[model samples]
Target: MNIVNEIISSLKKIQESNEITVPSIKNKLTFSQIHCIAAIEYIEDANITKLSQELGMTTGAITKMCKKLLNEGYVWKYQKEGNNKEMYYNLTELGLGVCKIHKKVHEKSYNKKKAIISQYNNEEKVTILRFLNDMNSIIEDTFSEVVENYTGSDD
Candidate 1:
């Protein structure tokens, strides 16, 4: 197959693998909800501002998600001793349980893919890695140019 077709096929396989592994954990939560939870798990005691930046969401959206999580008993928010206006959030027992399940699913998917890739010979592995790296670099460069043009400045 040609390079473009090969790239498309690889991306499709990646999407399929992610779907297979993600549905179990995602069934109990919306994609955005699960992403918020996972982001919180990564940075414990994060406030709304931090969550908004990390999740690429607006503070208002994060606040709504936080409220739902709190109401569902999956997370709790508390004010710091010296900062009553700034509240921090952490996952409760239920949230941690979900995080653990998500972690397990990710690990399983990684291991399964790794096992299959390991069967490839050293030369084949090197070629695959090189192609992936080159593709990533090309994508990054193209997007950077586009963003610079849109912003009217390059940093």
Candidate 2:
């Protein structure tokens, strides 16, 4: 297969791999939802805007996901004193547990990748990083254009 096809296939596999159930929650979560939960844990007093920025998602998408999360008992929303208009989120106990699980999952994945990459010398590693960075830049530019030109299409 060509390099582009290989990369696309790898991405599809990664997406499928990321669909996992948090043992504590016992419910399957989408990768994006898990990241949203992680973002909430990472950001202090997370709000819709902050989460959108952190996740590189639109506020509308974030809002919809957050509603599901709130309904699932993972997060709760609150308004700051004298700031009724703006709301913030806090991870529930369940959300914190999910965060811990997510961290462990990531640490394991990182360790596995590190083990694979450790065989590469410094120069090879630098080359790998450079290649990945270039790919990311290209993807980012393409994503920006797609978003800019996007019209309503049923997902």
Who wins the TM-score comparison? Answer: 2
What TM-score, to 2 decimals, does candidate 2 have? 0.78
Q: What's the lDDT for candidate 2? A: 0.89
Candidate 1 residue runs with Cα over 4 Å from true position: 1-6, 12-36, 48-74, 153-155
Best candidate, lDDT-wise? 2
Clashing pairs in 1: none
Which residue pairs in model 2 clash with each other? Answer: none
Clashes of each: 0, 0
* Model 1, span 25-77: residue lDDT tens: 33456656767777888886789999999998889999998999888877888
1-155 per-residue lDDT for model 2 (tens digits): 99989988986676468678667586788889989999999899899999999898899999999999999999999999999899899899999888899899899999999999999999999998998888789889988788777753434
Number of clashing residue pairs, candidate 2:
0
Each candidate: what lDDT?
A: 0.81, 0.89
